[model samples]
Target: MTDDLRLVDVESKHLDDVYRVRSRSFGLLSAGDREEWLSDVQGFIDDGRIVGVVDGDELVAAARIWAFQQWWGGRKVPMGGVAGVVVAPEYRGRGVGSKLMRGVLARSVEHGYPLSALYPATTVIYRHLGYEFAGGRFRYTFPAAELRSLGGKEVSVRRAGPADAKRFLELVGQLHAAARISGPLVWPEDKVAEWLGEENSFCYLAEDGFVVYGWQSGKLRVEELVAGSEATARALWSVVGSGSSISADVEAYMSPDDPAHLLVNKEADKNTVIEHWMLRLLDAPAAISARGFAPGASLEVDLELDDSELAANTGRWHLSVSGGSGSLTPSTSTGEVLRLGSRGLSALYSGTPLATMRRAGLAWGGATAGDGAIDTAFAGATSYMLDYF
Candidate 1:
């Protein structure tokens, strides 16, 4: 919120210049040898997902967002994912970055996303702006020597073409619907086109029709994996499991529990876990409503989100949901409420246990009343995300 800095919308025409600015700003690649970078930038532009900041005639900063499907916690909610936030080094400390972020976040709001998710380069910087560490991802080392073999009816896998777009997306959407940690399933048409345009990137389907489970593999990595059931998930894993080049160090994200610890493979060792991304709920009602839930009757909870960043999300509210669909409304009663700020809420939102939140001194309110509600909200649920934008 600086007076001098101004925000501008970037269009397709300015993509090359924006990438040049990004490259120069981040030292990503040698100047002028940026054909691939330009191509990636153009893809975002073509998808109608890139936004830029201009200082008069100069493009000083740029950010990109992509609309893709991800597992939220068992339901797929439309998410505005922020990425490629780059500001020219010369303008780094001049409030240009904040202006660029304000513009993009505003656009995200305009786009009707309940939340904005990003993997920030620096958590402290984003935290001040209301972003919170929502969750962490785990990289599991499924040792090649201990890799399990597949059995029980070989899944009929077929290479999918452009004609299979509808089927692929539909099946993936169904698979993510029951996932405990999933994101939006609507694929921006342009991004799909870009993924399909590549010769080495292969999309695979395993089923007779619409119910098929699907995945996409890039040249050196099995980038995306989605399936309707645990069996289907295992079948898809079998496909990637056959490849020895993937390294014993297999990687996955948005997984609620630590995958390294969850895996039964005794040989899988030297596991690594680290905080990967942060998420900010802009529309708490919409976001809380969008999440899929286990069986629950009703619970009225009050949340005081951060004022600096989640200014609109602050204040007390009541949440009621049965099955999976729910509603959040302003609370009228202060009686028997579970009171907590955005920090405590963020820790809980990111898969931290209620007891852990209390133990860490990050939570407030009466423990006896608050603990039960917090535990109920997160019970049998988990979150998972992917590193793709």
Candidate 2:
């Protein structure tokens, strides 16, 4: 019976079944939400972003790949954001989910994405698929009155709507690159425009900062707030805190080192929610080439990487980084090999320390001489993202 199950492109006929499965895994959509869900999913179907497994007439499992460009070391690399994964209760113990994921990975490669990431419901399956913990989406809560005290009113603030998406991206890009930030993502203009136009969110813009937030449970819920300078940071937080008359507190997804934290009267309380995300390298050389490196980091290290899912990535490769850029090339000459699998490589790609990878048993089997250089090349700002997709 398992042998008869097959993977297929999720189309109009399969949407209902896929919806049911998604509901089972996540939560059921209400009547109006279901219609909107169908409208939303139609875009994915048109773009061939969803894949599913079928058992004759029934769809047993499904997954979706979101087209994204994630910022790694201040550079944008095409990434496939995997989500909406689910399996029927009867199919839990079998290899059905794995089968569906293999198809998703293939589609990701076919679309030319060099990396893929997901917030895993569970880690074991994705770990086996070469995804390792790469970064976190951090949510910090602050006292609304404390934010209200930080004042920078001289800076011009304006209401931003769909028309400001391009400016928003441009400002974000400049800030991320200049800071050499890691683990943020950029949405294409159309999607950002749609997001800015969402019914629930209130969007605000300044010359160097922007914030998208909404009210939830009598508190300000900040979807994102990026500021490039101390003045803008204060101005933006003041804009958020202006709601303190009606709201007691505010919660935001923030870069741990955001300058706005310095402007606040007191630090946010200890109760922060951190959701970890995993990364998988779809094409090793492309990933290396696309990533930004430490400005003064200079090194040449040979690596022996074994990628089980993507055979094209299995081989000895030469890695070199200089002047804030890096490259990976296949080598024929035998060299000092630092051996690891996709998990180690992916973790390292996001700035995980070599010693940590070794301690976790994710990496080993090569000369230790290249360790320092390897770490230096990959190390930078702590990997974190403000958005959860």
Candidate 3:
């Protein structure tokens, strides 16, 4: 009976059971991607990052947590990237899914992740669990011939592979920090190596940047393209669009305000898809301390925050930001302080304007005077991500 369902660590032997549930919940598990999936899931198991819900011998629900360092205000903070959630259809209406995610969140906090984020299959459950819309993964498309015209033919580009992973990350760190980029993530060396070495992907390296792209549904899809200079940016775009004869269009994961868009000649309005992602603070103080603030921003605000899912986060807090860094401390408020739900604070952390949050009912309280300053403290580039998981 479902009443006997227990939350436990998933092991190698329980994989088939987990896969069965995944198939039932998400559809057929294709053989082509199964080997990679097994290897990836096994790595999570080895790292003690997999959590599951079981009834006797069957896994009724499961979720995987990825240890990721996500960029914010130009710095990276430890974040739990939750993914691959599944609950057998028959068990969906019960509390099993919640149980699995709660266990996962606890594990994430235990591992000292200050934040958690996910590209949701459905927002309701995670919203109930404390995640709020933080940012997006935007795919902007362009005619292949158009990208080709953003010439960098004078610049040199070289083929890159697994060995270039470290350099790739170094470039990313340099670019993101310099630009004060927000909301992208950097993978560990091994994961970066694995992605670079994928045979189907076209990987290239320039003096200051790199690009990874591959064919998908007759289109050249750019998984990631990070460039630190105008020349490198032009070089990468040209290389990806070089496949114009065979692929009429190109799709890339980038910010809505991406530098590449500057050279694209015209507005690209077709085939754009924005996938929203949710985030929450696992350790509110830590999350704030790690985030970079606008260098010119100055703010001192007290928030009466409520996190229904995590008791440690529910209370009054004094948030201060200056000199491109921030701090959050527990404090008593003498007046009706600004109040926010966990979701509201997270949305603000990712630079959502305070006025928008209030209208959406994500925030409230009589302390409305600080809205402009709070918004400025968190404002910068629009939040976005390149990688899906």
Off by over 4 Å in 1: 1-3, 11-17, 28-57, 145-148, 153-155, 183-197, 202-204, 208-220, 227-236, 241-264, 267-269, 273-275, 343-347, 358-362
TM-score of each: 0.78, 0.96, 0.95
lDDT of 3 at 52: 96
Clashing pairs in 2: none
lDDT string for model 1 (24-100, tens) is: 75766755567777777778777667777876666778898766444555666677789889987778877777778
Query: Scored by CA lDDT, what does every candidate get?
Result: 0.61, 0.88, 0.89
TM-score of 1: 0.78
Can you write out model 3's per-residue Cα lDDT over 1-389, one digit (the tens) per residue? 54789999999988998888878877875787888888989999999999999998788888999999999989999999999998888888688889999998899999999999999988998888888998899998888988887888878999999999999999999999988999998788998998988988899999998999998887889999988889889999999988889988888889987998778876455757999999989999999999999999998878888988788999998999989999999997678888888888788889999899899999898566778888888999989998887
Order of candidate numbers by lDDT, starting with the best: 3, 2, 1
Query: In angstroms, what RMSD does candidate 1 have relative to the true structure?
Result: 4.6
Predicted structure with the largest TM-score when compared to the true one: 2
Backbone clashes, each candidate: 18, 0, 0
Cα lDDT for residue 174, model 1?
A: 63
For model 2, how does the per-residue alpha-carbon lDDT over 1-389 read when each residue is reduced to its tens digit? 45789989999998889888888788988999999989978888999998999988899998889999888888998999998889987898688988999999999999999999999988988998999999899888898888877888888989999999999999989999988888888888998999999998899999998989998887788988888878888888888889989987899887777776666766467877899999999999999999999888999877889999999999998888999999999888674578889999999999888888899888886767678888888887877877777
Task: Note the residue pairs that clash in candidate 3.
Answer: none
Question: Clash number for model 1?
Answer: 18
